[model samples]
Target: MEKSLIKPFIAKRVAQEFTDGMVVNLGIGLPVLCTSFLPEGIHVTVHSELGIVGQGPAPDEANADPMHIVDAGGSPSSIVAGGAFTDSAESFGLIRGGHVDAVVLGGLEVDQEGGLANWIIPGKRMPGMGGAMDLLVGAKKVIVAMEHTAKGNPKILKKCRLPYTAINCVNMIVTEMGVMDVTPEGIVLREYNPEFTVEQIQAATEAELIISPDLKPMA
Candidate 1:
């Protein structure tokens, strides 16, 4: 087995998918890392369901504001210039009304058919599905940033074993091994990490993966 890219790099790769001036939501965990890797020269508005938009990266310990600013994950963050705060109702209204251009979320599993499963582990109790369900259905595009597998189990499966968050909602997935796009035909391997080969990725993935005609190195 090869050393796959780390979580931060995977989040960086996913951030490249964002276009200029898009209103994007970063889900908790890996998706939140996307904030630090956003491309330069493009102004993006970052929204959190916790009721803040135009937020920046997590603040340094010394500069952190204990009272006013924090991401949905409860990590201290800085608000970008012109950022505004709102209540949770208005926050979700922005999401459910289709105002968000894109959402990068962490997934426990994603099936070949583009279904997502991340809300719970089935047997264990979860904090509850916060806003993932709303974000999945409301965003103009949904990109999943997560590890390719978990404890050697392929998270990209032919069918998800865990409870699914949404069906056919994932537009693209950026994993440590590669980047895949979900198409009407199936999951297409678009880019792969330099450390792994197409065959290696196929072997690691349980779903039938289609190598894109234009497959390229992830770097």
Candidate 2:
């Protein structure tokens, strides 16, 4: 039997980090799902580098905002309150200037040293990095939410073989199996959702883990 590809799996996990009034930017593609995970009755202002701010999840079909449109990921999105549309130049300033509280980005490979490889892999045709560079540098916090593995093998590695987007930039990682915090000391086990063990997580990881003595299941 095949396993169910959980819809909004990563989205729900990313939502745990969201708080009221967070200035957030979700990377293109999967990271955009965070929009759909917003808690009702709480206002979270989302910023899209695509010249949009105060975005909400994709509008309901019947209640769809003709003017409000979501990205390709089916995430609900809208403009920020009293926001302005500016060119990429000014937009980047918001990122690099540390105005963004947290940014959720996907990754191709992430190492224990906090290096990220999300753009291109050699011998693979992929679009080059654009805003990721600025976001890595500017965002106050960075959370990388992705599947635990790639091609039956681990993408969480001891070191990244592909070219890096940034070093020591990622702060947290949420995998199908668990959550980890990247600290100067090591990758700290924060939350593990599924019924998995530290040994299982270690077996799945390419990097060494510093399991917290007080480790617990993810909420």
Q: Against the unseen true structure, what C-alpha lDDT does each candidate score?
A: 0.88, 0.79
Candidate 2: where is the Cα deviation over 4 Å?
1-7, 56-81
TM-score on alpha carbons, each prediction: 0.92, 0.86
| Candidate 1 accuracy as TM-score | 0.92
- RMSD of model 1, in Å? 1.9
lDDT top scorer: 1
Per-residue lDDT over 159-181 for candidate 1, one digit per residue giving the tens place of the 0 to 100 score: 88889899989999999899999
Worst 10 residues of 1 by lDDT: 1-10
- The whole-model C-alpha lDDT of candidate 2 against the native structure comes to 0.79
lDDT of 1: 0.88
**Superposition error at 160 for model 2 (Å):** 0.6
